[model samples]
Target: MTDSLTLRRPDDWHLHLRDGDMLRAVLPETARHFARAIIMPNLVPPVVTGADALAYQARILAALPDGMMFEPLMTLYLTEDTDPDDMRAAHASGLIKAVKLYPAGATTNSASGVRDFARVQPVLDAMAEIGLPLCLHGEVTDHDVDIFDREAVFIDKILDPLRRATPGLKVTMEHITTKDAVDYARAQDDSLGATITTHHLVINRNHILVGGIKPHYYCLPVAKREEHRLALVEAATSGEARFFLGTDSAPHSDDLKENACGCAGCFTATNTMSILAEVFEAAGALDKLEAFASLNGPAHYGLPVNQDTITLRRTPASYPEKIITGVGEVTVFDPGFPLNWSVLPSSV
Candidate 1:
């Protein structure tokens, strides 16, 4: 059964490989595992234009280790004033694969995000016409909304209307954490899909605060209750095309994560596929793993599925206490245990 679980190479529908030193340090981790990744654009200044995205893509390519085959699919961070002309030009140039919408103050380094959906109507309309996917951070920034309720609230107040306003727009809800999000993605047309992260599938909100404040477990669209975690697990293992892998493996220097107000994100890109294999195996759905990890994402994007294959073995492995960076080492969300599954070399 372990030998039979191997799959065609998978693409990470979502990933955060920070620029410069961090980018160099982490690119190998994700590139080692995923054939491609939908690179997030929430950099310090944010990649708000076609030019910025193109520049960022170059940096990613430069950072990759020699002999590693990894494609970094670029995305523009949409701002209220983002020019529709620029979006169309980017799509035509094939430099940009999608546009990411981060509502202002929605998550880490998202201060430059859009202040209102209405302000980006023209850009959204152009994307719909051009067939470009709008990858969303999927959380409302209202201060009054409960932290855990943000995903659900955004679905009701923002996503639904955005879908209506821009009919035929391709949307990928990134890092979905709740049952409401699961049901919403499933109900939408085939153009709409969602990315599920490794952390949300294995840990509940309680794991974040259980014995103590485990800052490493913290991430935006914070992990919800146990029931929500189970729902996410079910969705990922259900062989449903709407649900696919998106590590959203954001990395923050330890100083920032442990400070007065730690930023929101997790650095799980290193062990992402191993963690995912473990989750699906535990769910008794190993047969569906390949579809969730490999097929679903590219299918929704109208891209060809990867022909290369990768293997997953139920082998033991350990995670580091922290990954060193120039600024400071970043603590990883080590399950404080060994992983039950690991990826191995494979030939399709």
Candidate 2:
């Protein structure tokens, strides 16, 4: 058996690092393995302008633990009032990498998201012209739509129409959890890409509802049926350029998660690489790991891959059940199985 594997350092195409105390608590976990990450912009009030992105970027850098390095690729939250000129400036200045669209009320802190698709056409048009990508929370908010069908329905009713209308726009369907999403992304041109979350690839709907409710397994774009989970694994392990890693490692205090209406997220930033190594190795696709986790994201974003490297060993490793942060203790995502691969000390 292959005992150890080394690859170029990976980049998370989609991540959530909340600001202030929460940011300080979680930043090091991600920075330890990933060289960079596309930072999500869903904080309270949201980051809607170039200035907000710059300020947030500075804060992320300041909060980084000494000797640890990480680059924050900022994104702007798309709202009805989002200024096209500001987006252009942000993209041109290299502060913002993409614009995120969270159909109003779609996910956490998304009350400020876009309600009318027509209202943002100008911004979409400008983004298309400038070659900026759009990172989407690919689910609908219609009250009548079954929670499980929201993703598939969004593709047919919204994403398809939007792409038809905007000829050159680049779109990254974030944390896609359905076979329909997988097929849609596979059929699209190079302008399109999809990020498969670490947790989505590891858990399925049954993991959440099987033995009483497992709140830690719950996340937005909630894990689908086993069939869908299989599809995601196939795509992610296939070495397909359109599919890559995006550990939407959102952290919520244990108090918030165990309460009546818990927040949607999975805290996997701490062990994503190790878990991924196990998944890929299980699929007999260990050769494709680097492409999925390290190469594809940068190619899609028009950036260079990291020069650093990390190694994964076949030896067993143990991780904490929960991490104590200044805000509160946050539970780590449990894979529900023994992890045989563990990330070794950094090579760079």
Candidate 3:
């Protein structure tokens, strides 16, 4: 059995660090393990302009504890009113790394998301021309579409058509939950990539609904059937460059999560690396874990891989049951199995 492994530090291609007290509390968990992350812009007001992204980036840096360094690769939220020229300046100035599309009402704080795809064609054209990636929530909000089928439907109805109409608009199908998405991403060329969350690799619809309503297991692009879950695991462990880790580690207070009409997200930053190690080891593809978690995302985003490395040693992992923020307590994700690998302390 492998006892220890070392690889370049990983980066989370998708993450949500809500503003204020919540941000301060959860920022450290991810910074400890990742060298950087593609910060989500779905704040209450949403970061839609270059200035908004700059301010949000500042807040993220301020919240980051001293003595620890992390780069927040900020992104702009795509609204129908989004200004293409603003996006160009932001990317050119290195204030933003990508743009996010939420498909209005698709998930939390997505009210500002686009409802008219046509209105954003200008922005899409700008992105394609500049080589800036567009990260999509990858779900449609049509009430007629069954919740479970939303992702597949979005691919056929929205993504395919959009990509066809606007070629070269680099897209990352964020938090993909279906095999249809996997096949679609594979059929495409290098311009397209997909992100698989750590929780999605481990849980399925059964984990959320079987015994009882497990809110902590709940998340947007919600877990799908057992077959879908198995497919996700395979793609993530297959050493495919287009497939990478984007934990989508959204955090909600315990009170908000455990209530009627609870929010959609899972707080996984505290234990994602450990959970990923367990999943890859079980798949007998431990060797490929580095590519999925560390190498693949940077390659897709046109960024250099981190120079530092984190070593994971075989051992039981320990993490908090709840992270107490000023707003409320946020529960850590439970993988339903004891993790046997952990990030060892970096040697100075």
Candidate 4:
């Protein structure tokens, strides 16, 4: 049996490195393995302007502990008032990689997101012109739609029309959770790609509401049924360039997460590589792990792959159940099964 594996260092196509203490606390967990990540900008005030993106990027670099090497590919949160000139400037200067579209009230700190898609048409057009990608949260927040049905409905009601309107605009649907999403992505061309999260691959809705409520497994665009999870596994392991790893390793303190109105996220940064290794191996697609985790994302974002390499060996993987931060203790994601492949220390 194969006992050791090595590949080009990976990149997180979608990541949340919240500002200040939380950023400092979680940055290392991801940097320890990933070479770069498309950093989310849904902070309290959001990073909407070119100036805002620059400032946020500086804070992220400053928060990085010495001796570690990682790049924060910043993103501007798309808003109704977003300036096309500012976005083009950011992309031209290499200050930001993409623009994130969070439908109003869809997820955490999305109060400032777009309520009217038409208002942002100019910005979207500019993005297509400059070849900057658009990252979508991929859910509609309408009160009438069932929580589980929001993704599919959003595709029909919003995404389809939006893509149709902007033919050449590149798009990446983040943290997709359903078979419907997979089929839609498959039907799209090269300009469209999708990210599959670590948690979504392992847990279904049952993991959240089965015997009891499991808040840690809960996240925005919440996990779907077993069929969907299986579909995600197949797409990810299929070695398709259109799908890649985006841990979406969102963190919330224990106090905030285990409460009456808990936050939406799963902190998987600490052990994502090991968990992915175990997952890829199980599907008998160990050969495709590098393509899914390392190669696909950079190709999608038009960035060069990292020259460095990481090696994984057959060994029991162990990680902390909770990570302590200046804000509060954040729980690490529990993948349910024991992870047998651990990244070798030298690979870091």
Quantify all predictions' global Cα lDDT against the true fold.
0.88, 0.94, 0.94, 0.93
Residue 121 in candidate 4, Cα distance off native in Å? 0.6
| Candidate 3 structure, TM-score to reference | 0.99
The reply for model 1, stretches above 4 Å from the true place, is: 1-4
**lDDT string, candidate 2, 83-116, tens digits:** 9999999999989999999999998899999889
Candidate 1, after superposition: displacement of residue 204 in Å?
A: 0.9
TM-score between candidate 4 and the true structure: 0.99
Query: After aligning candidate 4 to the native by TM-score, how far in Å is the CA of 105 from where it should be?
Result: 0.6
Error of 1 at 221 (Å): 0.8
Per-residue lDDT of model 4, residues 194-281, tens digit only: 9999999999999999998999999998999999999999999999999999989999999989999999999999999999888888
In the range 114-187, model 1's lDDT, one tens digit per residue, is 88788899999899998999999999988899898999999999999999999999999999999999999888
**Could you tell me every candidate's TM-score relative to the true structure?**
0.97, 0.99, 0.99, 0.99
Clashing pairs in 1: none
The root-mean-square deviation over C-alpha atoms between each candidate and the true structure, in angstroms, is 1.3, 0.8, 0.9, 1.0
Clashes of 1: 0
Consecutive 10-residue window with the lowest summed lDDT within model 1: 330-339
